[model samples]
Target: MSLKQSPCKDEIIAEAKRLGFYKIGFAKVRSVEKASASQYADWISVGCHGEMSYLDRYHDVRNNPQQLLPSAKTIIVCAASYYPAKKQSIELPQIATYALGRDYHEVLRERLMLLADFVGGETRVCVDTAPLRERYWAVQAGVGFVGRNSQLIIPDAGSYFFLGEILTSIEFPADTPLTQSCLECGRCVDSCPGNAIIGNGAIDARRCLSYLTIEYKGDFPEGFSLGNRLYGCDECQAVCPHNSTPIFTSIPDFEPSDELLSLDKKTISELTPELFSMIFRHSAIKRTKLMGLLRNLKALD
Candidate 1:
């Protein structure tokens, strides 16, 4: 049965706020062929995707939301702030701030599912797991502007957040896109230790520390040192001027666990598969698996 369309955009936004999402917006599910795709294609063509073969699996579906859900009328884009004011101890083997808490995939998927249930229609919740171009959807939905570093930078909230989406047959109003672009501010580009940020909105994921530390399964590239990173690297985001002023997150689910924040090299090196599962069973770190994590630790040494 075709569901009758209603203007529930305001309600959806309100519920999103009540659910603790920092921001919510909407956009029409349409074909996108921006430079983003071309750049991604170039990256994939050169094998920059490394061992992440899933990225190459759904090229058409990932590029176009309509392909994922033909009947989908709107895309609900949401961002949840994961920023922590206090930095983790440098002596510890660092995990990304996003992984310090409950797995964002689980936390965000649950919230997005509730939204879908509230709307009551054919809908799907997509966190980081999906093939969708999440940042593009977020910008199209008017949640924030893509910065020079290619991270979505909200005016008030900065880039220390996660983006998620819900594709549904319901249409909603979208917010206005940000008018001010990064004014040739090369802070992020200049600050990138791995020199990943090439230019405005361009990133060589192959050289990106985050990609190397978390996504790549093999040994670290020649001359590239993992240092203290045990999970994901946030050096680029940490150095962005927009992210300079620490944004405190109120979501308890996002708070870093004491064990996660205090994990030392000794702990990580000695972590068995069973211990790894026990500690990160509810965290996104599980994505790397025990062997993958050990591989990352070895790179750091």
Candidate 2:
């Protein structure tokens, strides 16, 4: 239902924008669409989720909002662009734009909590770790539609944004979904080094470079190509036409540190646990840990 947004929404949009969130939209809580939920089940059924067995473990909660917060009537989906003002040199092992700065969990959570306090309701906050289908809610909240790369593409804003949610006991008028889809160009599909962007807005994590490098904890197959990647890959998003003029993130926490900028082959070879702990103490790069990162670096060689 497209209820006309009242002053409350205007206030929310204003406060959220002031907090450096690129987009904020509201959605009424509902069961995930069967088609979408089924599609996810299919992805897992075929072992497409790879080693992230948590998707299977939390199947029910992931598909239902009520399971997460029984009193949640409205979902506030906020998008934070991590598109860097400056990027690392191509000579270095590449980290994804989202990981260039502080861990998003800490950054977005701290900011979103401020927003929640402003809204003033019994609420729960969820970032990437939560079982919710975040991109789906992004669409539901009218923030954006899912792109061919399986990333949420906010029209004219690009897909370099991270999504976080606030489930509230208070109900707000829900926004409508955007009727647009990505340009039909198949560049993202063709650009995938592992052919992971399956073109139907579904990703085959087993063949996804991001998944292999960051999520999957296993060794690569023989003759696999890790390319120049250090942690995660962004082959598809980089090639998308929508990302040509990125809405560079305004969040200061997203800016790359001098140490992250200096990362290269030499630095990677010298990646000591001490160095790793010190550098990535608050970085998302900690997800893979030093050993996993070393494994990926070795595969690249």
TM-scores of the models, in the order given: 0.91, 0.95
For model 1, the local distance difference test gives: 0.80
What is residue 28's positional error in candidate 2, in angstroms? 0.5
lDDT over C-alpha atoms for residue 249 of model 1 = 73
TM-score of 2: 0.95
Candidate 2 ranges with C-alpha deviation above 4 Å: 1-7
The Cα local distance difference test for each model comes to 0.80, 0.89
Candidate 2: residue 71 Cα off by (Å): 0.9
Give one digit per residue, the lDDT tens place, for model 1 in 82-155.
87655588877788777788888888889889878776677888998878999888888888888888888887
lDDT of 2 by residue, 181-232 (tens): 9996999988889988776698999888898899988887787778988889
Error of 1 at 22 (Å): 0.8
Q: lDDT winner among the candidates?
A: 2
